[model samples]
Target: MINLINISKSYGENHAVRSFDLTIETAETTVLIGPSGCGKSTILRTIIGLISPDTGKVNIEGEALSTANLVSLRQKMGYVIQEGGLFPNLSAEGNVFLMARYLGWDKDRIEERIDELCELTKFPKDALNRYPIQISGGQRQRLSLMRALMLDPNILLLDEPLGALDPLIRSELQQDLKEIFSTLGKTVVMVTHDMGEAAFFGDKIVLIKDGQIIQEGNISDLIKTPSNPFVTTFINAQRNHLEIIGDI
Candidate 1:
């Protein structure tokens, strides 16, 4: 499990996140949803130790995330960023095997792991040899996911993983991602502004506004029991009512 307590971050005088607190349970998928600049991405980065919070603490599986343990802690969490973030110079297989090689896994084990991940992610066999630039955006994103999972991390952090894809591809990959997460049973935290995506993929939805959590709960609970006018307005703006009421 990942836990954040009173987490906050700032740049010069501008605060990016303020007194944020969240708990992501093991083997569950949590989605963070809000308008732009609500600090959703910042929360993911802070949890991964990429961005240091000015205040509060982060704990992963009961271990505090400190400078001394950041490297080891990060090795246990898979992170996928927007646009796939694959290295253009590396082949898909190379990208997936990079971390395992760095961790001193033998050649035979790395090859086995690569083949397993390719099968698990359902990428074409030929895709293993192709560079990121040579693959479609959706394929690249899958490759990115494969690379993150190569190390077999216990947690996954995805920051707008499908934000760059076309709607059709986004929808397709969303299903693929959901299936993979369900099969793997790894804890996942995803950040997105797309409310439909949030409702579809998240077991728990956290709504943020101006760097604060306005509300959080199951999708049904939030839709049926909005806490205030702002929550209602935000939900309406996202077309959540369509999801709640179903199309006529």
Candidate 2:
């Protein structure tokens, strides 16, 4: 489980994340959703140790995230960000095996694991030698997933993982990702602005506005009993999107 207790982050005069609190249970997928500047990604970064909150505690499983434990803590988590975040110069296999090599895993073991991840993410082994720029958006994203899962971390964090793909590709990857998540059963926390995606992926949807979570529940709760007018508006916006995309 991951816990963010009273977390807050500030940039100059702007408060990016304000006194936010969220708990992500083990083996469950939790999604953070809100508008563009609403701080969903900020919260995710904090969890991944990419950004340290000015205030509050981050506890992962039984260990609290601190300066001394940050490195090891991060090693136990996998993170995937927007645009695949792959190295444009490196081959897909190189990117996936990067961490394992750094950790001193033998060549044969690395090859074995890379093979497993390629199959798991449905990435073609033939394309493993291709650079990020050489692959399609969907394939690049698949490589990113393979890289993240390469370490076999206990938790996974994603920030708008499918936001860059075409509609058809996005829809296909979303279904595949959910199946992978279920098969692995690792705790996951993802950020996205799409409500339909949230409903499809999240066991619990945490709706945020201006850095604070305004409501947390499933789709039924949000549609039936919104906590405020803002929540209603947000849901309506996504419902409109769903009308365009058809339900996920």
Q: Which portions of model 2 show Cα errors greater than 4 Å?
A: 241-248
Per-residue lDDT of model 2, residues 1-248, tens digit only: 89899999999999999988888899999999999999999999999788989999899997889889999999899999889899877788989998899999999999999888887889999999988888999999899999999889999999999999999999999999999999999999999999989999999999999999999998898889999999889888767654767855
Clashes of each: 0, 0
Kindly list the per-residue Cα lDDT of model 1 for residues 88-155, writing each as its tens digit: 88888888888898999999999888888888888887878988888999899899999999999999
**CA lDDT of 77 in candidate 2?**
94
TM-score of each predicted structure versus truth? 0.95, 0.96
Model 1 misplaced regions, further than 4 Å: 240-248
| For model 2, the run of ten residues with the poorest summed lDDT | 239-248
- Residue 88 lDDT (model 2): 73
